[model samples]
Target: MIRGMRGAITIEKDEPQIIWDETVKLVQAIVAENNVQPDDIASIIISTTPDITSAFPARSVRMLEGWEYVPVMCMHEMNVADALPLCVRVMIHVETTLSQRDITHVYLNDAVKLRPDLITKNV
Candidate 1:
């Protein structure tokens, strides 16, 4: 079955290095939590808030070992009046045996406010 894992993270600043670091951290957590390899990922779609224009989050994912082969796209999030800032969100589609409910969705840092129910404190 094709399953998707969702994750979001908030960065401290709009700097390229910070965005890169946070993106790497978020993707790594999503991959580990889902127990899926990069090859298992069919595609990954990443979006950043309007304020985050310093870098494309997908670039960080491509930097990961073995992730270069994965198809990934980056986009800008729709601007909302009260939306979170410096937030990067990703949806990774993968071929997996896990059900939708069983998939772990991660929200880190200030982005945790975006999904209170799915946020895992320990992660």
Candidate 2:
């Protein structure tokens, strides 16, 4: 079976390193939570807010994890008024045997506030 897990996190600063570091943290948490092994990750799609154009957060994440073969993509988030800025959102398609209810999702930084109920349940 395959499962889709979703995660979103916000960077406190617009700087490249800060955003990259936080992105790494978020991905690590998400993968661990969902019990996704390196070979289990089918692909990852990441998007960042328009305000963040310095670098693809996914690049930093892949480098940190040393995952060279995982398919990764980074794009600009849909520009909208009042949307979260400096945010990195990810949707992971993973090959797993776990049921959907067992899947874990992650939200970090200000994103934790976006869905406090969910984060509280996981944390």
Clashes per candidate (backbone, < 3 Å) = 0, 0
Each prediction's Cα lDDT score? 0.92, 0.82
- The 10 consecutive residues of candidate 1 with the worst lDDT sum are 114-123
Query: Per-residue lDDT for 43-116 in model 2, tens only?
Result: 98999989987777888767855577888889888899998778999888899888877877899877876666
**TM-score of candidate 1 relative to the true fold:** 0.97
Model 1 alpha-carbon drift over 4 Å, by segment:
none
TM-score of each: 0.97, 0.90
lDDT string, candidate 1, 17-97, tens digits: 999999999999998998999889999999999999878888988988899999999999999999998999999999999
Q: How much lDDT does candidate 1 score?
A: 0.92
Number of the top candidate by lDDT?
A: 1
Q: Flag regions of model 2 displaced more than 4 Å.
A: 120-123
Q: Which 10 consecutive residues of model 2 have the lowest summed lDDT?
A: 114-123
